[model samples]
Target: MNRTPESLTAALDAAMATLDEAVAGGKARLTPEEIGHITYIGKGIALIDGLPGVRSEELLMLGDGVQGLVFNIDPEQVGVILLGDYGALGAGDLVRRSGEVLAVPVGEDLLGRVVDPLGRPRDSRGEPVCHERLPVERPAAEVMDRAPVTVPLATGIKVIDALIPIGRGQRELILGDRQTGKSAIAIDTIVNQRGKDVVCIYCAIGQRSSSIARVIEQLQRHGALDYTLVVVAEGDDPPGLQYIAPYAATSMGEFFMEQGRDVLVVYDDLTQHARAYRELSLLLRRPPGREAFPGDIFYLHSRLLERSTHLRPERGGGSLTALPIIETEAQNLSAYIPTNLISITDGQIYLSPQLFQKGLLPPVEVGKSVSRVGGKTQLPAYRAVASDLKLSYAQFEELEIFSRFGTRLDDETRRTLERGRKVRGILKQPQLSPLSPAEQVMVLYAVTQGLFDAVPEPELSQAEAAVVAALGILPDIVRTIEQGETLKPEALEALLAAARKAVSPLLGPEKVADDH
Candidate 1:
């Protein structure tokens, strides 16, 4: 032992091996689990053989930490849907079973972050340090464990809140043609959630990156990003990602809902989600049904949307409201997907191109849009002002349509048309400018009281602005409506007096008195 470099290295190696054997009790030989080799790969899918124990929906490791999900299993082989780059995969590649289902990181830290379906940060920020992981597929709360959807989720859109009030835990479908302000409604709803104690998750499936960027910018500009999480599976991503994006977003929102917090999740558009599912299913060789879609297409959405619910008090009393958007071709509601979602959701808000083209903005077709749960969840103040609005508007529309055909109109009909025009004006809200409860009440009360009847159509906007300003003079009216949830007769009288005072200068005293 002359202590040469070679001799010292040999001695050190021997000593280290002896220490490891001693620490391991001579049982240091570790046996690896069974591994499968890919036999075929294409179309974001692969077939693996040699792993007999792989289960459906189980995670598979395909080298370099890349993973896939076991989509189909057979005695001979298992079909896997690649969640990462498939171009790098080749035949004979070893894929190991992870023995776990796919999950996403979830926690409070996920708020204000942009991520993918796998919980990886997409905002160019590093990975989020989340303490908990949740499975993307979880059964919804049971009936007994769920509570009634009585609490209102104010969207701050006058038309929606006044006529189609969405309740907590409700699944309201926002269906319309492309570029018809469907996403606008969802974004505005998220923007309105600021300071409302509601967490928001916006999932973009198969949308353009530019579009997603614009949405992010809008939320940031409005300070809504603080309470929102954005999950994006853009148009260029694999279909598997688009398929899983909504479910992953739902899981993230579920974390908050379980903590007794209210949440709102928007599937920017499920039409693309459905298409992604169809692509995946067809690639997996599944039998096709209507429109070449998989037979389980309905099940795909039902399972995901069912997760949105309100838990009973014993189960934390939290709620998850779902606003799933669907795009139709040429405003055809008879399409298969639209009809499926319509049947699955509590009710739908139908956006009409005809109305949209007329510069009606949101273009929520009153006759076509119905919220089965919203009316019941409306605040008392709103209910009182809006109870007769829909009917009156419907009558006005009918008369207006007839009047358009050169039909004769009586004095009563003319009065009704004037009232309806004011109603429509009051409901036409600007983008990103959601109305407060007080403003809604003031505007609606004015329309109901015929205060704006004398104010011509061209001056409705200005008159409304003046009334809203005057409403500020009486903070008690707004506070009482918010707190007591109802407007007393005395409160209405005072509101009327205030409105007269507010509009006297704007509308001229003679017109104000004549209208009064």
Candidate 2:
């Protein structure tokens, strides 16, 4: 089967001809790139004097892999937002146009890790092994591609689940002053997604390292870190990094959401984000608006939050829920940043400093806190039990305020006041402790059935705990609620009777009495 020498030479000649043609084709194509120069550099921003073809939002590269985004295009120079170490860059340093937008790495390997705005690992681990890169900014899903938010996003906090529920893709703002347990709600929500198929992203912009460490410890303790990603731009980081942290984190979460998985992203507090933007804007010489913030401050937040939504089934039926936190000074909700966020978000959970000082754990100001979309997404079981709960609580609060004026209350008024006290007590939950839907339903049923009537306010927590334990052991009521069954009058009466029978013994005869 040996081939002739002349035939072999012919085949070799054909292979060489193909190779020469490919090289000629490669040489015919154009490979063009523009280079710029740093005219001036300071404060995490650089002025580029060339790259006339550079477009706004385009990325530029410097020596040693440093990157910058074209922020402000000017006649003489383009203001570039530095995304890396700008201290090493100086005037006349060569800068080449990347011809791409700033992007971050996103992948499953990022879970259970802490990273910077650039998607680099901050957990002291080696570099993250991500294969996909997404731009920091992306357009929101079109209206036709989005679905109505009809699914519940459980936070596991009794008060929130019962009253201010959050939907799967809604943007619910957590607004309050410092030490109002804002981050606690976010962390508890993450912990609640333990078995639920929800991916969580926590963006800590301009936060202390100690605070971030504590949050990581909490997640690891509860095993939530297995499905959660933490993006940090510490207080010591450049304002530019802080400004882009939430957006970068959003891109990471968006990656999962596009894969038809639900995602929950918490911007730990946007106050710091706004401040960072303000600093960067001023450094870039943008005009200041109210409170010295840039005029585009509203756009800054709306664009980020708008990225969170429920995709239609045609678009994979996934969702991204945003819990954006904003800090206010002296409880001023009308502040520029708070107001802007409140308008952009679906609703807000306003934590009251007054209630905090009074020893309420979450201190959620029910009067001010509202969930516009959650009402539609609330479980039918919860809706049946808590339909009148908020109204009754409001009435009780008004009556209590009036009673504080030294007026004697009638039996009905006094009864309302006592029930409200018990309700408040039941809602007081410890940080990091999350309740399941069934546990929440059982406790609310007990309250509605007057099971806590005899328990003193000081012992209400003990009563609720007993009720929770009884439900776990009895299993019937929890099973019904977990199955999403409707709790009718007759059915609730039976469940309450069984619950009372099981819980009263745990509360002891001294604390149990006939309310009728």
Candidate 2, poorest ten consecutive residues by summed lDDT? 507-516
Error of 1 at 194 (Å): 0.7
Cα error of candidate 1 at position 26, Å: 3.3
The residue-level lDDT of candidate 1 at 430 comes to 88
Tens-place lDDT digits, model 1, residues 1-516: 367998889999999999988988966688779898999987878889888888889999986666898988977888888888777878999999888999999998889999999998999779999999999888988888998998889899989998888999999999999889999999999999999999999999999999999999999999999999999999898888888889899999999999999999999889999998888888878899999988899999999999989999888999999999999999999988999999999999999999899989789999999998877888888877778898888888888898898878888888888888888887888899988878888888888988887777787888888888888778887888777367888888888788767767767777766765
Report, for every candidate in turn, its global Cα lDDT versus the true structure: 0.89, 0.89
Residue-wise C-alpha lDDT for candidate 2, range 176-208, written one tens digit per residue: 999998999999999999999999999999999
Winning candidate number (lDDT): 1
How high is the lDDT of residue 307 in model 2? 96
Total clashes, candidate 1?
Answer: 1
Identify the runs in model 1 with alpha carbons over 4 angstroms from their true place. Answer: 1-24, 29-32
| Candidate 1 vs. true structure, TM-score | 0.94
RMSD of each: 3.5, 4.2
